[model samples]
Target: MNLSKTELNDAELSRYSRQILLSEIDYAGQLTLAQSHAVIFGLGGLGSPASLYLAAAGIGKLTLVDFDTVDDSNLQRQIVHREANIGQAKVASAKSNLTQLNRLIEINCIEQKLSPEALEPLIAEADVVLDCSDNFATRFALNRACRAAQKTLISGAAIRWEGQLSTYDFRNPDSPCYQCLYPQDSGQELTCSQNGVLSPVVGMIGSMQAIEAIKALLGLPTLTGKLMLIDAYSMMIRTLNLKKDPECAHCSSALTERDPL
Candidate 1:
């Protein structure tokens, strides 16, 4: 679709010219992308690339939540923050970079932990939520919140050259929530701290998460109800179909209620 000169200024048009050229995301889709808001959890490896791409894509607003501060170790994967920002809160550093990437978008930096109390309000306001956190606690927290809010959740995780991406939409009756595939009580333990991660692997998966979020917001088909696994070591990509669990407390209850539980 053609965009009026006023609708897309020279700078705006130039910035997204390549993306706007795509028929699926021309001026109209770019407009929708520019008007959408996304909430991203974490500010580490996965979050770093996801937030940067979304901001660069001209997402109208972004809410970034991260309780950590920039560190020398993060420089390897968290490309959004610089060495100069080592001591600064990750959210602040990320916001600063995002603002520079796209001045037209609004960004909210929450330099606080993602607690249950704060999850609902933030998730409610976002058209889509990106779960880029590394830990299970935060991941589960985000999943629960998104399920309750019936918001589409795009989750990505990367460690040791292996990455996984999944979309959870509790609003869809047959869709599986994150909790359905990975039970909170399963007691599976894995972390970047415990296992090394390739920096580029995080970037690859995180950027895909941003793509999924944008697709979800634009009502385009996505990886929902499927888990995408990637092994950077072998450059192999696999898709696993996910099914809603009848015994999953979070999704099962929502299923029974026929609404966000």
Candidate 2:
């Protein structure tokens, strides 16, 4: 994605004034966000809020990926789709809602499952990538892609009354990746639909994902190399520091290969 003009017009200044007012963000940070492209995979509970906030916050371009159709069951927590969109594809429904929120931003929709080839180009184009995808396969796939590209990836997952968030800035060689945290693929995956999720648990994590994405675009401090764990039932949040694995399959070898000769 091309970096759009940093200049904010009269209407843009008015729309994003509150964010621009923050000393940390100010006008320059907001402009950086306006020129950044965020690629979000999955338009479910987590992706819904993430996409909405990113769009409303004035991110210049957003690429939404999801192959599922909206279902009545999804309305419990997926806020991007409506009753009328039950049969509609998730990316389509998300694009409609996000466009309604911010018409000035560019929104692209992908309605198919991505192969590694497909994901690579998206990762290459994105300033930041959000892995809101459910299964570990997709998560691992995305982690590998981001690591190969040395891009920034913000990932979130929620199941039952628990949720977790993490950011892996692959540009920083010291930053641990998603695979560093979950090295093995568990055959069986836990999902909100199969177990149960408190609706707001996903909302909280998703909203935080958007914040991390914006911070990435603006060079702000983010959750890179730390895992945030939330348990709604206990009302507790904990962050665990992560370290790069020297023997890890995904990144360690690559890091060694890039070592100074």
TM-score of each: 0.92, 0.95
Candidate 1 residue lDDT tens string, 59-172: 878989988999899999999999889999999999988888789778988887856877777888888999988778888888878877788999998889899999997668
The global C-alpha lDDT for each of the candidates, from Candidate 1 onward, is 0.85, 0.89
Tens-digit lDDT string for candidate 2 (1-261): 465484888888999999999999898887888888899999999999999999999999999999999999999999999998989999999999888889989999999998888888788899999999999889988888888888999999999999999999988978988878888653577977679998999999999999999988888899998999999999999999988877677666555442111
Give the range of the ten consecutive residues with the poorest summed lDDT in model 2.
Answer: 252-261
Candidate 1 Cα outliers beyond 4 Å, as residue runs: 1-6, 253-261
Clashing pairs in 2: none
